[model samples]
Target: MDVGQQPAAWHELAATFATIAAALFGLFFVAMALHLDAISTNVTVRARARVSLQSLALSVVQSLLILVPRQPPLWLGIELITTEIVYVMLGAGLRVRAGITALIAAMPIAAGISLIAGHGPGLLLQVPAIIIGVVLGCWQAWNTILPAELQTRRTVTKARR
Candidate 1:
């Protein structure tokens, strides 16, 4: 696949990414709802949840940009970079782990920039990067919820004792 050509295959890949990101977002929302009490009681857990949501949101936007009909590469690059900056800033205001994850999450933006500049493997690199970001986001969200649930259970057990 030529980097200059926007193939149907590439669009299909982007659409698949969008679907996955949306599904992950829905799952995260359900998990948060189920653990709302634990999440609300802890600032760190809340920040982690926020970071996870932001990452998933970024994945959806990036995938949509790729799927957009006749979208210019320059616009995609600009939007992706801008989104990464915003995400990193938001993470910086949270815990150190979130800030680190935010930096890792921006890897896709760099790949997107390379694609726009026509230097990279185009859709091949972009697709993987987007998927990785979504996975990382889901992992972060799980990390947040699981620990909180365990802590809550422990607290209940102790109180009963």
Candidate 2:
């Protein structure tokens, strides 16, 4: 079930697919780097993109371990951690502790999924993905509190003026 265990042709095909995904990821970062205007022009859009990218990066890691046979080596882990640090910086700029709890919660869930799937789920990884997806979705769904608090504080200060 794992990539190493697959037939030669299937392994080659999967490697090709992984290469394509990695290329696309690189292109996205390049575009993001080149177009500072997109973020500068719309703060809200930028904030959303940061959060989306954080979730996306986490999902990518999870997928690599569960769905794909390649359990990213140490370098990939380092790269992901670095990317997360950047995401955390952007998130903190938007809100003091934005995404912290969700990110923390995601780690164990992803690991649990991997453990359950036994490194190669063949197809059972889908179940764990659904479970983790629900958990993350719920966290986001309830993320309104922080924004609401900020808005309330702003309103209070405005009333005092």
Candidate lDDT scores, in order, read 0.73, 0.42
TM-scores of all candidate predictions against the true structure: 0.78, 0.36
lDDT by residue for model 1 (1-161), tens:
36533534568778888898999999999989988889988887888888788878878888887777777666666676777678677663254465556555556567556656866655555666677678778877888889888978998999999
For residues 1-161, write the lDDT of model 2, one tens digit per residue.
Answer: 46322223234443443444444445545545555454445555455445434544544543443333443433333333454355445553243243554554444444344444446423232234324433442343234233434555776799999
Worst 10 residues of 1 by lDDT: 1-10
- Tell me model 2's lDDT, rounded to 2 decimals: 0.42
TM-score of 1: 0.78
In candidate 1, residue 32 scores what lDDT?
91
The CA root-mean-square deviation of candidate 1, after full C-alpha superposition on the true structure, stands at 3.1
The deviation in Å at residue 110 for candidate 2 is 8.7
Location of the lowest summed lDDT over 10 successive residues in candidate 2: 121-130
Give per-model CA RMSD: 3.1, 10.2
